[model samples]
Target chain A: MNNSKQGMTLIVKTVTRVTVWLIVLYGIYLILHGHLTPGGGFGGGVILALAFLNIMLAYGREATQKWLNLKFLEDIEAVSATLFLFMGLLGIALGGRFLINFLPKGSPHALLSAGNIPILNILIGVKVAMSLFLVVWVLAGLHEEKGGQS
Target chain B: MILPYYIAIPLLSAFLISLIAGKKDEWAVLLSTTAGASMLILSIYSLIAQNGETFVYKMGFWSLPIGIVLVQDGLTCLMLVLVSLISFTSLIYSVQYIRHMDRNWKYYALFMLLITGMNGVIITGDLFNLFVFMEIALFSAFALVAYGGHAEEYEAAFKYAVMGALSSALVLIGIAILYSATSTLTLAKIAEKVPTLDPGLIFWTGGLFLAGLGLKAAIMPFHAWLPDAHSSAPAPISSMLSGVLIKVLGIYTIIRLYFNVFNAPDFYMQVFLVLGAVSIILGGLLSIVQWDMKRLLAYSSISQVGYILVGLGIGTRLGILGAVFHLFSHAIFKSLLFYNAGAVEMALGTRDMRKMGSLARVLPITSATSLVGTLAISGIPPFNGFISKLIIIIALIKAGAPVYAILAVIGSILTLGAMMKMQRYGFRGETEIKKISEKIGWRMNTAMILLAVLCLLTGLMLLPGIRESIVDPVVKVLVDHSQYMQLVLGR
Candidate 1:
């Protein structure tokens, strides 16, 4: 019955509010530059998921729920996966083998240099991010339910 | 081009099922059934079209050795057919079976994903790719086994997950060791390099692979989790686990790696023979004591798998033939038996044999189909099991392993006694009047009946024409190791 006790203390919340956006921006950068940089979709996706987790940690379940709907997250995960598979099938449809890089490759280090690699990285990043978010949401929901009961 | 569809169709369907089904059970059923049926048709077409030749599909147009390639040969085609057939039947059965269960969409989604993983495992030509596909199939199976949310289901699933994770770790380590030794991840390249590897490293890598895959296949010493997991899972899943999953992920991988990639020495074959013999005796003896119908069938799977291993271990062309034939026959009859068990459970609401009896009067289709399955599995004459068992015994004699030949015969007798006991206790007594309905769903009945008919008819596959077209090429793939490398690597 103590509404004030929902999230962390004020100092942690303040720090988290400032840092989460920065972390998310970095994750997007990593995914966008995945082909040229060391970090790819999986690594960047985990970071993005962590950014969302930081919000949940600092702002409590209610705020996090409002910001990121679980159903929407699941939809994103499914759509991204289908998109990735479709991209692979595109090669087959285009008179090549499955998962073949069908697009023309530009020069290295350019924004759209690696053809399908960047597109695949973005799709995988979104899928992995949503999948991890869903997992954390479920586990946290279970913890909340158990806490309320006890 | 067609080879990739085996993996693509299942993967696409899994995502589509999840995306569209949301909370609708009917959509889930329709989507999954369509996926399963299409996969079955595709596999059959590929089997007929490819004949005995090997076809390799390079992913992303990357040439052989560097990019991931999907290889379709006689063995792969046979496995693809078996996986799709069993998956299709199980999906049909699940339409009615899981209707009442919550989150049926998730079940269908995981089932599709599991098929994707199995198909991928059957076709991939890369060592690391095999590990990835194995994990996909395994993770899905772990979830499916625990779908019921019962305490027993959770416990069994946890044990299965732990064992599966350990085995996967070992497999990864083996792959790492092999890669470090050979400097390549392609299976064909590894096979070419295996000849010059350090003896100690080869011994270590081979031991790791055998133990890891042995655990997956539930070979005797490493089979502790199978009974609990298989018995606790839903019946359709139990059928998948027993009929095709173990064969694809465990035995198929072992045969491919040992005979082709590693060219394992004679001592390893002896090890396989001994392990097979022990599992035969132990799995059979254990099944005879189980009162739970599903558990009895689960234990029997171990025993049947033992027969396949022993046949393969004999290391002759005929022996491999017998093993491949037995694998095919076991897939048919075992899934048939499991589906029958599921139907019985659906009608009677109890898996305990002692609780009800003489249901043959009410459940005529289930009883008749299960009778056929039981007869085939127990190696009665004119049934498929008998032909495969006979070939294996003959092969053992030809290979000059009379002691193993005798052990195999003894295993057959044990299997017969156990199955007969099951029939007597589960189906032959006075009918019990229960609150549950006696009429099972037509979909379940259709799946069981089709499998039962397949069980009876599969014996003709031993005829020279059928054998040469289907089973012989698989046998040759294993017996002649050089052919695998040559086919994949183009000499």
Candidate 2:
């Protein structure tokens, strides 16, 4: 019941501590298996972001800031988006159309089989995860600032 | 293949500018200006290279109907040129205009993203792709409208976002219906299959599309957000919104879907006529009562857009040609007017027409250029608006719609009255506030001057040689709806 610390109650934190990593791992699995599964870049990316949001909700702003700074998250978002665009352009530079699958298609079901799908998934996952974190960070900051001022 | 760069360059520059801008204003401006310039050049080159031919580039090496494709037809080329030109001018104008504002980088980034979205919408050969691009444009526009972060701006942006989202939902439902009925997301394939489907289903889908795109276009009853959104945003963004966004996101999509995809049913043509006439009458009447400079311009945009719609609704070859010409001319003069209004606000620190006086003596360049814009917009002789309006009226009568032609003429008279009111009160009257700064920045002046010149010369596009080279192909594409499917499918 002690609200002195910057987070929720002990039970929620304890539960989040166990579940967050599992959710993150599952997201990565979904992204890796995107070509063979129903989940792709966007679906897995949202899940990954949810994992971070769980940590933020359970441990609060200061702890999240320690783990990932807002400025660093913004940079990651921008860089990842730029990387996705660059990869698309790289397709054209390699004598194919933009966003074409230029790499070798190994096997259908394997993790690395889908040419460029996993790479794109990873890039989108990072971008989406960082973007959601930044949004939460800003909202939290605004709330704290208002609470302090009033 | 070359078509992808139209989208790629802006997307790349947008993210790169965000990454590198980091409070450095110069990088954002330079990168965005360069991107806009490159897009303009690329569009011109593509226009020349295609030379009335259609070029389709398939993404991921997938064949037509299976993969995403970018089709550069005459209509697409015309839209690309207009988008790039207006965006380029706005970026240049923003260099000076937005210098006083915070977060200049985000502005440039959003601006580039908007251009990317418009280019994607213009070139994409897929239905869902158009929807995706519309979202990109809408999101950026919503943000840009609220960029000032004032109370009124927030209110305007919230209203715009709600209306925009509702419209987008309608469009999605329509797309879903079309896809369910035809089992295809490719526009060309849908066009080929749409005629064979149940007329009732097609009518429902068409109605949904009209309501959705109509909201975005701000046609008559759906025009609640334009006055606030156009007037509250920063000046450069207002120009972009009025000059290109509605035309591209709203009118262009409506035309593409109705004419090409749906084969221009007579029922929809009648709908276009009614909506066009109502919007023209209401918008012009509303403008006469406004004292705010940008608000007047905003209402005027609605009226002018109605003219374009009327032309399109007439469904004659001359009518289509007039519509296309008026569209191009409107892009030039409306942006010019918005820029001039921005300059006036910059100098006088007020948008109220009653407070502005003797600006012609102090801000000579802006005043002069704005006069040209006013005359052009009023359909005065020798300017671009006159020729386009004449064509539309003549075409209307030729199509045996004398009533609509008369209504159009009435709209023109009201437009002239409103513009004369703006010119007289805002620039010609005796000096009201003597302490206000009279000087406008050089970049702002240059942009307005450039647009004014274009406004004067764009009428030349109606000439036989120029008409054949540019406007005729656009007319051809719209008139022969089957040509769209044939060109995209290479049949």
Candidate 3:
């Protein structure tokens, strides 16, 4: 089960350690700038998941599991989803429409201009990122249950 | 005003359970049940309060041309109420049933997702939206069917998923074609532009839709997946799959598109009639030979669905009346019977009829409730099925198709014989039963009892005054689908 936490060779591990943060930064940019650009929550989230997945490849699943539990990912994933729904419900609770842009429209093509959209995008990005990571982690068979049925 | 809550509460609670219902199964049970209960109330209230009024909710404050829409008509409202009521009962039943699998939270989460998908399908006002919601429903259904983690369950779920994917692809192609023809995704907008388009476009798109959606409904020809998929799922899920899933995905969408979107083309109506007759006989005959209790019920579901199709095929108001009413009655009674089947399987640890006998003495609640379901399904004199079937037969004769009327009668006889087979060998046989576990919990019995009582009570929906208030608007909405286009667009 690779309990000693060994991963790839020195070159690959060094490359991943160096490049992973840039990918994370790029994913965050996509999520935050989703309202102004094409890369919204979904695209950005995939990139983030890929970054973590790269870390898993370089550092080994056992090391990743030590730092990042799937249970935490599941909880955060669900929290992000619930937060997204609450934002929609927030629209309804305000006595306006169900999912109206109730916030102030700052301006066009700006970072904070699209009232509720950027926030919703951020929530979706968080959810997508965590959900994707959890799926890949489980499918990778790193979290095998004890004597579980197939 | 409350239209959004139909989808909102379930979607919210599904995630909330995963977030907050941590570790303890009881918390998951409590949270989801509250969500399901509120949903049921909202649906029933919608049926009464909407009162033949149509409501539309636009997402994100965008107009209909640009934003997605959620529409609540009489038909949609009726289905919303039906789906919610059935799901609520099933959730109650699953509280104990899922404990055996040791994964209550996951099951409840998936179940809530299922309800969300169904509610979304019933409420959405766009073609692409239906496809998206349909996928949501099917995905969860696939997972739930395989929740038992057994080899057979996985095989059945895989088969169902493949068929589901194929049907969805056809539906997507039709939607893409429609978008190309009309350059819009809203159903009413497509209807507005359909008459101005070329006839060949309509023909191809309509054919694709029928083939795709027909597979979902398990009509006579495309019903290869129903028996396995419906029979293999856990009991409550089986009830939901057999009871509401087929109707909403298959029959409901077909009715929506064929009648409202396409303007009830005479050609499709004839096709529905012939196919409906064929399904009745085919499903009936096949059901008689099965010994697996759920499998027999599953086959019988295809036949029961056939009755709804035949009713709709008649195209008269009386025919539509019977069709819609049959849909309601069939949903209740069929789910009731599935619950009984599930209860038997739970208690006996087997689904084979040969191994079960004299269960009426042991599982008395299930036996009693199953009697109501059987009579209601078999179209006995006093139950809801008899009234709906009689209405359909009378409409068939009035439509100058006496041959179809006789075929309906024969289908009835076949249904009776098939159900009788189950009753005789399954619960009333000479094989003495022993060693029943305390598997049937109060919640399970409560769910069965609720649906069984409704099986008999739903016949009152046939009474003249109540019919006008409850059933007539749904028929009017379906029969005159052009009115649907006008109403949605006009609003």
> Candidate 1: which stretches are off by over 4 Å?
A1-4, A144-150, B431-435
Model 2: clashing residue pairs?
Answer: none
**Is candidate 1 or 3 superior in lDDT?**
3
- Deviation from native of the Cα of residue A96 in model 2, angstroms: 2.4
Q: lDDT per prediction?
A: 0.88, 0.89, 0.89
DockQ of 2: 0.59
Model 1 docking grade: medium
| Candidate 3, residue A19: how far the Cα is off, in Å | 0.9
lDDT of 2 by residue, B191-225 (tens): 99987999998899999999899989888888999
Counted clashes in each candidate structure: 1, 0, 0
Rank ordering of all candidates by lDDT, starting from the highest? 3, 2, 1
In the range B125-171, model 3's lDDT, one tens digit per residue, is: 99999999999999999999999887899899999999999999999
Instruction: List TM-scores for all candidates, in order.
Output: 0.97, 0.97, 0.97
| Per-residue C-alpha lDDT of model 1 across residues B113-134, encoded as one tens digit per residue | 8998999999999999999999
In model 1, the Cα lDDT at residue B311 comes to: 88
Angstrom error of the Cα, residue B140, model 3: value is 0.5
Order candidates by DockQ, high to low: 3, 1, 2
